[model samples]
Target: MTLHTAIVKTEENKISSEEAKKFILSEQNGAESIFVGRVRNENSGKEVTAVTYDVHDQAVIKSFQSICSDAKSKFDKNASIFLEHAKGYVSVGEISILIAVSSAHRDEAFKICRYILEEIKHKSPIWKKEHYIEGNEQWLPGYSLRPKEEIK
Candidate 1:
């Protein structure tokens, strides 16, 4: 398969890089790019204790597939892509997102990896609530549902 995508429930399961690597590996690929996004200890001047990800599962999955397919069309058709995002409570240092891409060239591998990430950020229905060390939590602003042309 050229694409694999899922939303992993952080409470029971964690995103694994090894699995991503294994999935995207192919004899046809000459370059591999993997991106691991972790829940940071700080965000916007606050000490972040953890993060909770809420997802519209069906929409997110559909978007992931579309995004990966678009990336392949735009870059390399033979590219293999693996993408997974976390849901539920994710502690600091835990993974929030993982993307792995393998292609025939380094440039295509890198572009596909980055394209998947950026598209997910803008198009996926995933929300984040950050927990601060001072016993406060706030839902951060996510991507606008409006079309890009209509936003201005």
Candidate 2:
């Protein structure tokens, strides 16, 4: 298989880069690129203690599949990709997302990895609420799932 994708619920498990690496490893691959996203300690002057990710699981999986396919078609047909995103409570320094790609060249691997990440951020039905050290939380603005022309 050229692509593997998932949405991991943090309460039960966490996103693993090692797993991703293993999934995308190949003897034909000359280059490998991996991206890891983590819940940060701060955002916009607020001290972030944790983050809650709410996702529509089915839709997110569909989007992930589509994005990975598109990335492969656009960059390299033989690219192997592994993508996973965390759902539910993720503490600071904890992984939120992981994308790994292996391909025949450095450029193709990097491009595929980047394309998957950008597409998911724009197309996935995932929302985030940031928990702060001050005992408050706020929902961060994210890209709309609707087309720009549809929003009037």
Candidate 3:
């Protein structure tokens, strides 16, 4: 199984779900599951104009690799994982993250894809600052990693 992970800090482009899907396509893997995260137009009832993501690139990459390893261990060792996250400004309705997993069966692919996304949200050191349409801005904290007992 192959693992591809990236933290893109450039504003030249956004995370592409198609590209991720294309990269994860393999003849050996019959099932491919994908999860795409997009910047919402509103958050907590406030209209959001954009979201700027700040990340410790090295640390996030390491965390992502570890997440992929965990997924492999928990799911199928032969599954392939592809994860990508945007590090700069993302406009409303734009893609911010892409996760793709391929495995021999649908169940493993689905579970691994979900697990990687959840881990990224909880464990990765990526910060997001939301810009409101009214010119207000605020940094939001992501959810903390769940304890071992909390994980099923």
* CA lDDT of every candidate: 0.95, 0.92, 0.89
**lDDT head-to-head 2 vs 3, winner:** 2
If scored against the real structure, what TM-score would every candidate get?
Answer: 0.95, 0.97, 0.90
Pairs that collide in candidate 3 are none
Better of 2 and 3 by TM-score: 2
Model 1, range 39-88, lDDT digits (tens) per residue? 99999899999999999999999999999999999999999999999999
Candidate closest to the true structure, highest TM-score = 2
State the TM-score for model 3: 0.90
Q: Give candidate 1 regions above 4 Å deviation.
A: 147-152
Candidate order by lDDT, highest to lowest?
Answer: 1, 2, 3
Lowest lDDT sum, 10 consecutive residues, model 3, at 8-17
Pairs of residues clashing in candidate 2: none
Residue pairs with backbone atoms closer than 3 Å in model 1 (clashes): none
Error of 2 at 145 (Å): 2.2
For residue 78, model 3's alpha carbon misses the true position, in angstroms, by 1.1
lDDT tens string, model 2, 35-129?
Answer: 99999998998899999999999999999998888888899989999999999999999999999999999999988888888888889999999
Query: What TM-score number comes out for model 2?
Result: 0.97
Clash totals, every prediction: 0, 0, 0
lDDT of 2 at 19: 91
